[model samples]
Target: MGVHPKESTAQNIENIKRQIGEIAAIYDWDMEVNTTDPEFYKWTQWIFVQMFKKGLAYEKQMPINWCPSCKTGLANEEVVNGKCERCGADVTKKNLRQWMLKITENTDRLLGDLDKLDWPEKFKKMQAEWIGKNHGAEVDFKLEDRDEAITVYTTRPDTLHAATFMVLAPQHKLAAELATDETYHCPKKTMVYTPSLIWKFI
Candidate 1:
């Protein structure tokens, strides 16, 4: 009983509503709410429009966790082990135009306001941990043959001089650029580089 973005069209919504109605009637349940209903979604759309007007919502092209099977982008919390949490399908990074809400803009306010809530201590602690406030400086490392520099954020900038090796995620844009050997490049665009080669360059 799930409706994905692709199946949220007028015709498909009507079909889903009819199906749900039949099921509710058989069960004799008070199913007064239908999210697919235009009357309901219009308010949701209005709220989004208002947010956009206030500069709280914006559209940008960025790397996102994409579920190929579902044909939709997912949030960071919706992805598990590089897979879609809903469909259990392998998720890949895709640069797509997406609507982003400026939640970070209210981070400090939200964190301070949490003190007013009557929540359990453990729950409050978890929420605070999730917010993850940290003071750090971004230091750039120059690449050997490239004009580009890789920036690393660290809380302890003093220890950065002693750092010998650096690791980048397989999907990182620089991982492919830094890979010199043909074996490191794959048809699926997954980059793999040797530690020795990376150390030699850096």
Candidate 2:
């Protein structure tokens, strides 16, 4: 919040922030660690620059509901019935380049330290689920007819003998890469197997 005065941060955004601050002061909700503090922001900028140099911060294409009229990306909620709520422009899928932080690099440590935090069991479980710190192995299964073998990550490697068929999520990266025709997503990861199912666990 403090450091990111990126080109994206406009005067209107700052105005809204100031307005929020003014309104909060009336209710005595003074935020201690203010983003407006230059002393705090400089350190943030330094840290971000260091992270960028270390390859921890990088850019990737992210699909989103885009509003061409607004010239800005709209959140799913901001799209009303396939149109932008603000300008009523038809929402479209766009692969916008976005800066992403490598939070997965710290996943192991975060998952391990979850028990040390003072939180309810349910909330801790939710955090763990979101972190996706699963104890699993990737088993490489070779296809019978084709030379290419798809890699599947599974928690139940013990059930390999019982596996009859595999199911792949329509949105899996491999789905598009391996598909001969047009394709598409699901929350839970899955495996898809064809008649060429041949197991070679690695």
Candidate 3:
């Protein structure tokens, strides 16, 4: 339905624009907006700067779909069946600096106001899901051999006694620092080690 701007010829671009104009005429649209306009993106950058100044945006390291061929990170939807949808390259988890919004700070007020809106029951439920608030307790566990403490969020804190092992993300410093070996000689009871990058500590 659309011709990619980067790869498309001038004729392709003109054809698509003509099709869109025909569609717009059917709806009697006042104007058509071109998303490739740099001026429009400047407004978005200004909005982000405002959010950053308000402490609503911050950078954090997070795992994302990485394409080796593209040498870039792809969104979750951009990865199809563990491969990059664009280049068909195998997608892997790579930690990259990502901007995060502190929308959770207003989740309470947002959820509270949803009930006051005149909407359908299912629509209100959808709004609640969009807010995505979770009631959980952040239990802090102290490391037995170190002065470090790990905090975990759980909706069921009562079953914490069964939490014999903790699964640390691949980006965790302990995953790289503490890993010495991978082979475990359980039968001979000689070697015991954590996984290479995915640490499953007991």
Best by lDDT: 1
Candidate 2 whole-model C-alpha lDDT, 0 to 1? 0.68
Please list the residue runs of candidate 1 whose C-alpha ends up more than 4 Å from where it truly belongs after superposition: 1-40, 65-91, 182-201
| Candidate 3 Cα outliers beyond 4 Å, as residue runs | 1-14, 21-25, 31-33, 115-124, 180-202
**Candidate 3 to truth, TM:** 0.72
lDDT (CA) per prediction:
0.73, 0.68, 0.71
Give the number of the best model, judged by TM-score. Answer: 3
Error of 2 at 109 (Å): 0.8
Query: How many residue-pair clashes does candidate 1 contain?
Result: 0
Candidate 1 per-residue lDDT, tens place, 1-202, comes to 4776646666776786689877874543465555767888899999999999999999887777778889998999999877789999877777667799887777798789889999998988899888877778999888777798878789999887788876655545666556667325344332112111243326
* CA shift of 127, model 1, Å: 2.4
How well does candidate 1 match the true structure in TM-score terms?
A: 0.60
lDDT of 2 by residue, 38-124 (tens): 777999889999989988999987666777789888888998877889988776656668888897888999898998999999999
The sequence of per-residue lDDT tens digits that candidate 3 reaches over residues 36-76 is: 56766788889899999999999998777778789998988
Give the worst 10-residue stretch by lDDT in candidate 1: 188-197
